[model samples]
Target chain A: MSVIAFAKNWNGKFKNSTFELVSYTKALANQLNTNMVVLSIGEVAEEELKLLGNYGADKVLTVSNPQLNTLTSRAYADIVAKAANSVEAEVIVLSDNNSGKAIAPRVSVKLKAGHVAAVQELPLSLDPFVVKKSVFSGKAFGHIQIKSDKKILTIAKNCFGLVANPCDVAIEEFALDIDTNLFKVKIIQEEEQKDKVILSDADIVVSAGRGMRSPENWTPVEELAEVLGAATACSRPVSDEGWRGHEEHVGQTGKVIAPNLYIAAGISGAIQHVAGISRSKCIVAINTDPEAPIFSVADYGIVGDVMDVLPRLTKALRNSKS
Target chain B: MKILVCISNVPDTTTKVKFKEGDSLFDDSGVQWIINPWDELALTRAMELKEDAGNSVNEICVIHVGGASADATLRKALAIGADKAVRIDACPADAYHVAGQIAEYLKENPFDIILSGIESSDYNGSSVGAMIAEFMDYPGISSVTSVNLDDDDIQINRAIPGGKQVLKTEAPFVAVVQKGIATEPRIPSMRGIMMARKKPLEVKPAVELEVLTESIKFELPQEKGACKMIDSESAEQLVELLKNEAKVL
Candidate 1:
């Protein structure tokens, strides 16, 4: 049986998260000595689809349907389940993001596969098929054993690196066996952020917390992100106070982010907040309080006012770029 | 409108996690048990919707897949505003098993709307809500921030990576809500507490599940090392360190 990885598409292009899934799934499939197949949903250009081979996909299945462009959980799950069955997949892989977390369970239930979410590493033993996952809101790790022949695993964002390993990819067209009534819930509105790095796709993120004070002070944060070509995020309280939109919130209940470099300005790290970014490669904390909890997790910390440090950091980045 | 809200009894968020017996068992010796925060948020939202529906909404039933150990949490839910409670007499082994048990219960007693947290704080699996919807062959929506009842249709908004999207669906739907679904969870008052004692707390045996996953061991995350502290005034020096020393820049 083959291994399947579903690659999500948005704005007529594959999401960057798919690459990470492909890289890791390829490694996993190799461990099982199976073929690595990627299922790309929605409209994707053939040339862009061919790039999947460079990321280690042995074959790419593109499901091109105008009606399937938008994300409706039921319809998407149906298509994924059908694809997995067609391939007779033993394992299905997805990134543990909003879309993945939403769809993985439905697909698992449909395929009767054991599902494991927010997995950090690959399988430890192929016999029992054990995997490590974060539990207790990232306070601890648990080794889970999937006792089923079929399994579904969702990797945490940024937990696995996207390493390029070229494979021969044969692109195929997949016609979805969709039920006509699946379009009951239509997406009324979709507001996309154009010309900006997607937060989950970014390698570097500059986040702020309540220490930033108000929404107005967020300008420097944005400016710093702009200079560094990074995405901006906020702590839970910042979003709760209406200082930032809930979409920018990163924590246990919010979006979990892991990037190469995560810089926090005026953010005290709560266990919940730290849990979200625990996988970050490097962390830098900037706050006036020397005893702030963020420092314990930071590789480097500056005990200074965010207002004083932000402008200087932005200016330094601007100078270096110019 | 009939609504079923699913809650889980979890350790308090601040409680330190400890494992015993080769890291296979969660040590609950002195840990304080409370309603899972995420489930509390979902419960509050369900209660608010019931209030808004007024005469149209008849009851808000809270359910849990646990043994007598979870009755306290069920009582707390009743005090918070649930009309009744259902305790499936079983300890949840995993998310799949829990979802299966909840689905088995839901099949017997159908409801118009099924609401639950995105996931329990302890496991952080974030799959039970969607799995239940799938098992029952209902439309399931996750990361939902707001739910507004428009007669038979329910308009919901959910979060994405960098934004949010709005969807409109009819009844017999499942919603997995997050923090923005409710501002705060309701605290049990003295009068409400007294009345909860009289409220119905039904206990039902759990259905057998074809459990698929098992936990083998647990390990704590590595302790972080000493942080490299820099002077507050040395902003340029910090930048130099990020570039040269940390090499992340």
Candidate 2:
């Protein structure tokens, strides 16, 4: 009859996505009126888990072991499942992020819990654990109910705002008998894309596409992001040509994003790309093709060659900043 | 290198997204279907692994969990050179249900390698592969960008927060393939297309897992305001408009 959340750890430093996730989950905790426990797995420090109090966690449940440093599907899932069972938690939440996406269902299956992914809102009903989630690539919302003893949820990024609290909570570390052999796969090293914003977490995003013509012309798009402090994204076709990294691709086939503002330049918004980002609060489309599908959904649409339009816009933003 | 790749039939990337009239059901009127674009990456990578293994790669089997519409996608995989295909002839609404069907099928025939798309473009749930891997008790890695097999061991280049990680595992594992891993998925050659005609395609009914969620309604987002134009003469004017008008930054 309690709620618990898992806060993500990226390297030694906290990831912005993790903080956003914790902040948002607190909203759900407040609505439920249940004790909230925030847990950080593996060797993440005790002090780190305590930070969850500010994000709405009533208590911090941490398990520290050197063996937990490398994340394996089996090991991580085992720890999470064990913790939930021991605590008899009614609800469990995690970021609908890389590791969470991979392990959430497995944990749900183990707990015999009803699971919901891509959640954008708190529950309208506590019993049956009914919650609202975006489905069909954000084309609609599905009301999901958990028909089991526990419910698992993967909350979408930036969907809920985090509110900071002043109270501090103490951390309680648990000893887990983890079996590393169960993890059939092992990671040697992880490499991240540079000069790009993660589409899933970007608050304001600027995207380009084949309309930019080639990789050489991507500078203007990058410049706009720099000035706006926005993330860089692309249409599927751009990623196909290697003009941009795969991480930047935003479409039904790449990533689903719901940023505060999405600025698409030199990109003809395909239906698939639109499906992915249509949930953005505001979209500004800049393209030379007046009839581009992008204009159909844009808050502000401009018909002009990006080669000329982007430079002017970048210059405008820079001059304004100075 | 016995490879297993999962595929889903999805609306073509360019297909307009609109639900059926008066309901949350998808509108199929003008919607053309294709192999989920993401699944194409998984299928191609599996075929490549089977090629590299040669004799060691006994077979490359394709699997699908859907209604009859999924058959076309399975044949498309066969056209791309999979030796055989399976269709769990049930329409699934949840990841757990679909994963259950695929997992049950795999239990009968253990594969050395399981490949799947990072996410299905239609539902875009992105959870089936991991559930299948867990059900079958195999090591699983999702969103793998590049893969290489050396001496019965697989090395994966995985996308991560700061950079990509190099992951290594033995055969009998699972990976959800992502885009940008290969050139456009190879269209089946005419010969392969012809041979696909004779390949084995087994169809089984989908398992019934209890439905957990129901759709109340599908609402299209609110329309945006019309475009505001800025004359191109002065950058200062454009900046003034952005700062004072659009207020995006």
Kindly give the number of clashing pairs for every candidate.
0, 11
Query: How much is A224 displaced in model 1, in angstroms?
Result: 1.5
Write down the lDDT that model 1 would get. 0.87
**Model 1 misplaced regions, further than 4 Å:** B53-55
- The 10-residue segment with the lowest total lDDT in model 2 chain A: A8-17
Q: What are the root-mean-square deviations of the candidates from the true structure over C-alphas?
A: 1.6, 2.5
**lDDT by residue (tens digit), candidate 1, A7-105:** 887767765677888999999998999888899888888888887888898788888887777778888889888899999999999888888988999
Clashing pairs in 1: none
